[model samples]
Target: MWEYTDKVKEHFLNPRNVGVIEDADGVGEVGSLSCGDALTLYFKLDADGRITDAKFQTFGCASAIASSSALTEMMIGKTLEEAEKITNDDIASFLGELPKEKMHCSVMGQEALEKAIACYRGETVPKPEGNIICECFGITDRQIEATVRDHHLVTIDDVTGHLKAGGGCGKCHEDIQAIIDQVQGKPMPIRSEAAPLTNLQKIRLIEETLEREIKPALHQDGGGIELVDVDGNRVMVKLRGTCAGCKASQVTLKKTVEAKLRELVSKDLVVEEVRS
Candidate 1:
C-alpha cells in the first residue's frame, strides 16, 4: 500500500464540500469510471466574481477523493483568475504529498478546474487532440509526450505511475517508451519481433501483469488473485478473499484476467480458475 500523508487521510475520511451546487455558476468534470477515476466540481461565484462556494463528487481511489476535496477547499475563496493559477503540483503540495503512483489524481483535479473556468467564460474547451497511444486508458501520444517533458519522466513505469498511460495491458509500453526517448533526446531503439520467452521470463511477466494490471482492481473490491502455476500457455489461479465467492468472478476472469494476460503476456495464453 502507498503511504499517504496525514492530510490526505484526513481529507479522504472527512472530505469537505462533498455535494452538488445546483445553481452553480461554473462546473467542471473530468475522468471516467471505465478508466477507474472520475470527478465533478461545482462552484458558485459571488457578485464580484469571487468564488463563494465550491463542492465536488468524486469516484476513485483515496488519492483521487483527497485531491478533489483539497481542490475545492483551495478554490472556494479565490477569484477565478486566482483559481486558474492553481496547478497539479500545487494540489499535491497542499496535501503535503501524494504517492507518486497516484499523481494522476492531482492532474485530474487540475483539469477539472480548467474546465470549470472555461465553462464560466462561456468557452468550450476543445477535446484533446492526438493519436490514441494507450488504447486501454484512451491516453493520447501528445499527452504522453507532454507528461514526459513536464514531469521529467525517465521510464515507462514512471509514466504509468504518474499518468496511467502505460499501466494497462502493456501493449503501449513501446510507444510510450518511444515518446520518452524522443522527449529526452535519446536514440530510439530498434523494434523487432520479440524473441521467444523462456519459462522463467514468461512467469515473471505473468506476475508483473497481475501486480500492475490486475491486483489494484480486485483490491478495490476487497478481493485478490493468487498465481498457482504456469504450465505452458495455461495459467492456473485461485481467487481469494471476497473474490472467491463473487458471482461475477467468472466474468472477472474472462474479461479482465484473460484479456490482460493476452495483451501483456502471450497471445496464446489462457487463464483458468482452480479451486482452493
Candidate 2:
C-alpha cells in the first residue's frame, strides 16, 4: 500500500523507453529476480560523448519501474561524467518524493548506472566483499555501512526502509542497530554500564514519551492514546477517537506505540491494549 506520486504512477503505467538497444555503447544490469526487483539500462553515446539515447527494462513494483524510467530520461543528453554524479537521492528528488520504504528502488537505479558506466569504460566491477548480514535479502555488511553513512540513517527502521536489511526474520536487527550507532557516533549501551531504572522512573518516562512523542503523532490522524496502567515492564493503553476500532490499530500499536516506548523507555517494555 505504498503512496506513489502521480509521476511515479505515470512512468510505471507507461514507461518511456521499455526496450534494449542492440548496439548500445553501455549496458548495465543490476538487482536479482529473487529479490523481486531487477533493472537493465542501455545508453547510446554520440561522437561528442553525449548520451543521445537511453532506455531501460525494469521488473518490480510501481516505484521500481518508475525509478528506472526516470533515471534513463535523466541520463539522456548528459555526458557520462554528468550522469555519473547522479545519486539515489537525486532520483527520488526528481520524482518529487518517494515513500520511505520504497527508497531502495532508487538505489537500484544508481547501482545499475554505475555498472553500466563500468561496462562502457571496460573497468572491473568490484564484487561485494563483506560478509552477508541480512540473509533474507542477501545484504552485506559493507552494503549496510555504506548505506548508513551515505543516508545518515539513525534508527534500525531507517536502515530497514532504505535497504530492507532488518525487515525480514529480524535476526540481523542487532547487527543493523550496531552499524547505525557506529555511523551516527552513538555508542550502543552496554548492559553492565547502563543505569538501572526504578519502577517510578520507568513509569514517568513512559508517560512522558507518550505525551511528548507518541500522542502528538496520533492526534494528527484523529486518534489518541490513553495510558491505562503500568505493571512492571508492561504498559496498558486504550486507543481513543478514530484509532479505537480502526483496522490498522494493531499495526499502530506494535510498530508505532510499542516501538516508541521501547526506544525511549526500556528495550524490554511491552505494550498491551485494555478493553472495556
| Candidate number achieving the greatest TM-score relative to the actual structure | 1
Q: Model 2 clash tally?
A: 0
Per-residue lDDT of model 1, residues 1-276, tens digit only: 789999999999999999999999999999897899999999999999999999999999999999999999999889999999999989999999988899999999999999999999999888778999998888899888878766667789888877788888999999999998877764223323388788998899898677655875787688889899999999999998799979999999989999988877778899999996
**What would you estimate as the lDDT of candidate 2?**
0.87
Poorest stretch of ten by lDDT in candidate 2 = 184-193
- Kindly report which residue pairs in candidate 1 clash with one another: none
Q: Could you give candidate 2's per-residue lDDT for residues 110-178 as a string of tens digits?
A: 989999999999996898779999999888999998787656566888888788788889999999988
lDDT of 1 at 224: 85
**lDDT (0 to 1) per candidate:** 0.89, 0.87
Runs of candidate 1 with Cα error greater than 4 angstroms are 186-276
- State TM-scores per candidate: 0.66, 0.66
Our tally of clashes for model 1 stands at: 0
lDDT of 1 at 212: 50
- Residue pairs of candidate 2 with colliding backbone atoms: none
